[model samples]
Target: MAVALITGSAGLIGSEAVDSLVARGFDVVGIDNDMRRRFFGDDASTSWQKSELERRHGRRYVHEAIDIRDADALMTLFDRYGDSIRVIIHTAAQPSHDWAAREPFTDFSVNATGTLNMLEACRTHCPDAVFVFTSTNKVYGDTPNRLPLIEQDTRWEIDPGHPFAEGIDESMSIDQSTHSLFGASKVAADVLVQEYGRYFGMRTGVFRGGCLTGPHHSGTMLHGFLAYLMKCTVTGTPYRVFGYKGKQVRDNIHSADLVSAFHAFIDAPHAGEVYNMGGSRFSHCSMLEAIALCQEIAGRPLSWSYEEQNRVGDHIWYVSDIGKFRRHYPAWVQQYDLTALLRDIHDQNVERWHAGATR
Candidate 1:
């Protein structure tokens, strides 16, 4: 039987990948050490998701509490699976922009070095496995912020005549920008993934994703935008809108949709290819727009405050141009739009809060 190893298996993307792959008949092995709890606290812990997966999938989904930074541990797993491992979906990382500045070492080690370890394991033990990496749009850093943006009532938008008006693409320069510590580390890992595929001929693909969110996300203040927003709405917690008049925009792709893209790449494995993945024009919103949606879902006014200071190296407007991926995999299409996606998150979060499973 074929085996697939997924790092960050309890994460929003990783967990979704596990369920999708397992249902498709692969014996899935997952690696997660609940580092999210360490990164964002108990409220953002994925322990519940991990338990749920094990309870539901049982023997079909093997769970490992291993850190990707531990090369020996990763190598052991790689050797154990050997040639049977047909896919490696790496989603584990210290995913935070502001948090990265606090501990650059931990962020870099986890994001950059951890990716290297995974690549080496694939090369050494399972060279033929399809390696799919979850990179971030932050890789373009503040470069996107340089675009001509107009302030709408609820969101910032690119000039209609601009090349990137539709959305930013992979062609955007990752150079000469203020990439936060997190973005820099991801850039290092992203480039390395490409080099491994191009230089060594490994089947690897890098997806530069926008706001990836869903019900399974352990949404925290530092990351998981849409999910975290829903969490705040469900609990009536005060939500902070940082800078750009809360009009900074982001395209959110459902976790399941992103994982489907991963499966597409795996089915037709490519080398060193990069795709900007997100909702694009089909779905996106600013903080203000999202707050309105959250309020509608909760049937109450959301408690939110504004901060004049924006996040460092944050984009003013970013919707991914998924044209390349769509062109490559013609069968791939978005399963959920923004309204349906937010509703799913709102309903799930409400259920979790009622069950006393969330903060």
Candidate 2:
């Protein structure tokens, strides 16, 4: 049996992977201990999603509550599946910059060390398995913030004539900038994946994702940008916008689109291939633009306030250049733009958001 192993398997991307890969007929082993709850509180818990995957896929989907930080447990699990593990999608990490400062050690151990554990396990038992890592745009730290930006009515945009107006690509350096602790840790993990692929001939692809989002995200104030915004819109919860006149821009990718990209890489494997994966110019929005869209979609004005200070290392404008991925997987296409993305989020979870708000 072809087995696929996924870390953070209940998360927005991971859960999407579970559903997609199962439909492709791969028996999937999912590793997640619900650390997101520990990092972002109960509202961000993915336990509900975990139970749903098991229910829907049954014997085809195996859920392991093993912490990726626990190497011994990982070795045991990897050994059990052995070489049948044809692919490993590592997405589990402490995902919030604000929360990372509260416990740097916890963040490093989970993000950096946990990744190492997965890499080593794959090398030991299934060295040839296609390893797909969900890295972040934060790996560029505040470098993107230094781009030549022009402020428009609703968004901070890169100067139209600038070379990167198309969008920031893989050429952007990941050095010499403040990366928040979360970014630093992710950089370490991202580099490690590259090294493993180069040195050991492992088939690994590092995907530096922009705002990865979709209806599956258990979005919280500390992370999951788009999800949290729509939740606030639907639930009448007050939202806060930080700095950049609330016009800072981000490109958002639906989880399904990202997972499809992962499958593309797995089929035609590469070693240490790094790609900037996000909606790119196809689907991007500013804080103000997103708020307006959410309000329009949800048909309710969000109660929101702005603070002068933005989150440390937050980008003023960032849209990924997915040209490389497209050149490689030309058939892969993005299905949702900003308005479609927000509308899907609202349609899927309006009921859940309303119920949670009452609590």
Candidate 3:
């Protein structure tokens, strides 16, 4: 059986990719040291998800609790697997802009240096493997915030006449913008992934993702916006809405939908390709809209408050233009819209809470 290696394998995207690849008959190896707990405390631990994957997949899934920053350990695993590793899905990251500021060194070490380790291992051990990096839309930095936006009663919308009314595409500049420390680290990794494909002629695809969300997310204040919002609504926890009058908009794609795109790229591998992956115009919500939806789904009013200051480098409006991805892979399409996606998150959060499984 071909081996499929995944970093951040307990994460929302990583776990989804593991299940998808295993269903396709590949032996899966997952690398996750549960760094999330270190980043966001016990509430954000992914240990439960890691255990669940091991239980479900049995011997087919090999769980390696090694930090990607440990070059020796990663190299050892790569050498052990050798050329049998057919795919590498890199979803591990220091995902929060706020948290990245507090510990810039740790963020850079994990997001940038760790990615280098993975790239080198792939180059040496499995040069033929399809390498998929789950890059963030933040790589564009605050560039999208400069767009002309019109605020309505509930949300912010890009000006209709603006070129980006449809959504921001890849042509937007990644330079001369206020990228928080987290964005900078991701930028370093993002460019390196592209170069690996272009310079080394390796098959690497960088997906600049928007809000990637699903039930599996261990939501926290600093990350997992949709999941955290739903969790707050379900548990009667107070939710804080920062900046843009709670009108800031985000396009959210379900984890399953994003994983489907990865599968599409794997089937027809490309070298040094970049795609803006998100819900696009088909599925998006503002903070206000999201709260209302969560409240409706949970059958309880969410206790939310607004703050004047927004998170540094946070986008006021960001909806990805997925036209390029769709044109390239006609078979790929979104399976969940905004309402359905929120409902799923709400139901899952409630179930987990009631089961006392909030790990």
Q: Count clashing residue pairs per candidate.
A: 0, 0, 0
Backbone clashes in model 2, listed as residue pairs: none
Q: How well does candidate 1 score on lDDT at residue 279?
A: 87
Best by lDDT: 3
lDDT of 1 by residue, 1-359 (tens): 89999999999999999999999999999999999999999998989899999998999999999999999999998999999999999999999988899999999999999999999999999999999999999999999988999988889999999988888999999999999999999999999999999999999999999999988888988888788888888777888989999999999999999999999999998799999999898889988999899889878887889899998998889999999899999999899899999998877678767676763
Give a tens-digit lDDT track for model 2, residues 180-230.
Answer: 999999999999999999999999999999999999999988888799999
Q: Candidate 1 at residue 34, lDDT?
A: 93
- For all predicted structures, in order, the TM-scores are 0.99, 0.98, 0.99
Worst 10 residues of 2 by lDDT: 350-359
